[model samples]
Target: MSNALRVLMAQQNFLVGDIPGNTQKVIDGANQARMQQADVVMFPELALTGYPPEDLLLRPSLETRVGQALQRLCDEVRDIYLVVGYPRMRDGKLYNMAGVIHNGQLLGEYAKQCLPNYQVFDEKRYFSEGDQPLVVPINGVPVALTVCEDIWHPGPALQAREAGAQLMLNINASPFHIDKPRHRTELLRERARQAGCPILYVNMVGGQDELVFDGGSKVVDVAGELLFSGDHFQEADYLVEFDSASGRLSCAHPSEPHPTLEQSVYNALVLGVRDYVNKNGFKGVVLGLSGGIDSALTLAVAVDALGAERVEAVMMPFRYTSSMSLEDAEAEANTLGVQYDVISIEPMFDTFMGQLADQFEGTARDTTEENLQARCRGVLLMAISNKKGYLVLTTGNKSEMAVGYSTLYGDMAGGFDVLKDVPKTLVYRLSNYRNSISPVIPQRVIDRPPSAELAPDQTDQDSLPDYDVLDRILELYVECDYSADAIIAEGFDETDVKRVIWLVDINEYKRRQAPVGVRITQRGFGRDRRYPITSGWKAGV
Candidate 1:
């Protein structure tokens, strides 16, 4: 019997609904792993069709396409055992499956035991739960197979141990959220200890709409010592050698230290924008740089993600726009080395006001005028997007999005929202974090109070609570599902709690129409949190 085994973890990014392309990726990955003399190569869950294929899983040809792709992998890949995830059909029900392929033959298949259905997962809508454990012998060592969610629970690992598995392999299409990596590490330690075998976990990477998968694929020894961790938010194959006699695993290097909160979130945003723009075949991205922190930070991220050459910054100044704004906007563009333009919205605003003069006869001017200014800028940016084929990026953050601080079809008229899930407080912190790396954002932008620049001498606090306080309340209410009284109990002012919750409830319609952005939280305003817009549900204890 062989005393040692080498396994390659194929941490890859995949395009959704592209069976043919994903199949080719698998074939190429397998061939590459073979060149490295790997005994087996493992891929992430749903590698054949990409994760969360959603309604695409309901397509009538899913089975046919999956079968064809699997056949191609078996035909084109040789010499190395390939462990990959795909959807399988049996007895008129679908299963999230992982199959073992060796030398042009299909060896064994394992259905995912735990189907996740909460918070962006709807596996129960399509896939039936797998009831049995799969143990396959690879190079004289008995290996256990489990899908993504299986390892989170104790039963799967315990069952594998009972099945006499010496090593465990878990493939995943897990998406990123704050603190997810740390949580995964802790869970891996628990699961490995339970299974009484070393565990090799592989995860997919890249941005898929609102979700970003940070590929921190890792391996843990039988005692739950993390041996290696791949880099976050990148695609690379890693080699790990397992010693059969000692029942342990070894890597050429040690585990990579976990990144700080700011570092991880920033990387997730960059990867999300990069994949979304490139994968969608956009010429580039353009955003309105109001000399404010949100847009300024967005600009930095765009340049970092797609390079300065592909990004364009437009400053649409109005009467309400300050001189500091104009100067800072230009300075930000210049610092990033991106194309910068100045387009005054004075004429458009005047024209719109003139046209609405009769309709607004004797009406006291309030937010309507402010909204019109924003609309003019949106029109210009959208026009440029149409003409140049550049995707328009919106710059609203989660705090504004929570309370309907954004004007619909005005600031929200864009293809993507870069900070859709980031709170205003986090916005300032992230801006500082980016500057710490290379100083792209202007210092004044981070230091100055945030404003929409649609009204004179206005700051965000004029309408909303302080961002630090607001963000904490939002975390408790929106993310934690706390009632108004519960948030008040958290030591926030009762008045502020009630007011914030009311705004959040009333602003559901606006958030519904906002562009999709990178989701970096446990409860972003995307698919992660779904609420009825017209519900009579009121804030209470």
Candidate 2:
């Protein structure tokens, strides 16, 4: 029996639906691990097809491609045990499977037992759950295998321990949310303690549409103490040595300090934008720079994600545009070293208002004029995006999005929204966090009152509650699923709570049309929350 077992955890980023590419990555990763003297290497769940492949799993060629990929790994990889995740079909049913390949032979396979069906997961729609546990031997030490959601529950790990496993390896495609890293650590520790064995977890890193997987893979001792923690929001490989004789584990590196909440969220947004733009083949990104905190923060994020050369900021000024905004916009662009342009939207606004003069013969000036100004700016930005092959990044945050405070084809005109799921309060906090690294955003930008600048002397609070109060109410009502009365019972104003809920309920149509953004919360407005646009339900209950 071997005294020491070397395991390599491959935390990698994979493109969805790229079976052949992902296969080659697996082969390369396996060979690299073998060169590093690892006896076994483990990859993330569904690394062959990427996570949440959505409807792509239903393609007829999925099984064929997976079979060929497995064959290639078996042929090309040698002198090491490869535990990889892919989809398998048997008896007219599909399973989320992890297979062990060694020296051109398939040794064993484990199908995922727990299928997650809640927020951002629909595994039950695609896979039939496995009823049995899989325990394999590597280097004379028995090891149990489980998929992402399995470790969240206690049954699978306990089953593995009862099956004579000395160690456990769990592969995952877990997506990021605020404080999820800490939650994962606590969960793993409890699971390891319960199973009475050391557990090594490998998670994938990268952004998939609205989902950003932060790769903070971890290992915990049998006593529920952490041994090693991997990097977040990037791909890396680490080796861990397990002593079979004494049941001790040693890692090449120590756990990195966990990031602050703001840092984690900022990193997630940057990764989300970077992958979404690059993966979709955009040349760069362009956004309207209103000099408000929202656009200022968005610009900083874009520059951080794609660099100054790939990002462009345009200031579309109207009659009510402030001098302070103009100065701050240019200062911000210069500070970030991005291409800056100032285009006056007076002509476009005049043209539109003239065209609509006859139809508005009896109409009084209200939000219509304001919306027209926004539409002009939107049109200008969209034109630049079309000509430059840049993705338009909208700057509205969740507060404005919730209250229907934005125009349909106006501020919402973009292919991607940088702050779609972020609340107004958090936006300020992130801006401050970004500046703490270095002062790119001017202090005045952070200090000034936020405004749309569509009308004279307008500020956001003119029509909305204080951001602190509004954000709290939103957290309760939108994320916590608190009814209007329940929120009011939480000591919020009755009028404000009812009004906020009404706006959120009626704005489902707008949110449905809004561009997808990074989902940093468990209840972000994308896949996490699915409300009908035409529902007759009220928020009173």
Cα lDDT of candidate 2 equals: 0.93
Candidate 1 global CA lDDT score = 0.93
**Which residue pairs clash within candidate 1?**
none
Q: What lDDT would each prediction earn against the true structure?
A: 0.93, 0.93
In candidate 1, position 296 carries an lDDT of 96
RMSD list, candidates in order: 0.8, 0.9
Q: Give residue 29's lDDT in candidate 1 (0 to 100).
A: 96
lDDT by residue (431-529, candidate 2, tens digit) is 999999999998899999889998999999999889999999999988999999899999999999998899999999999999999999999989999
**TM-score per candidate, in order?**
0.99, 0.99
Per-residue C-alpha lDDT of model 1 across residues 437-500, encoded as one tens digit per residue? 9988889988888888777789999988999999999999989999998888889998899999
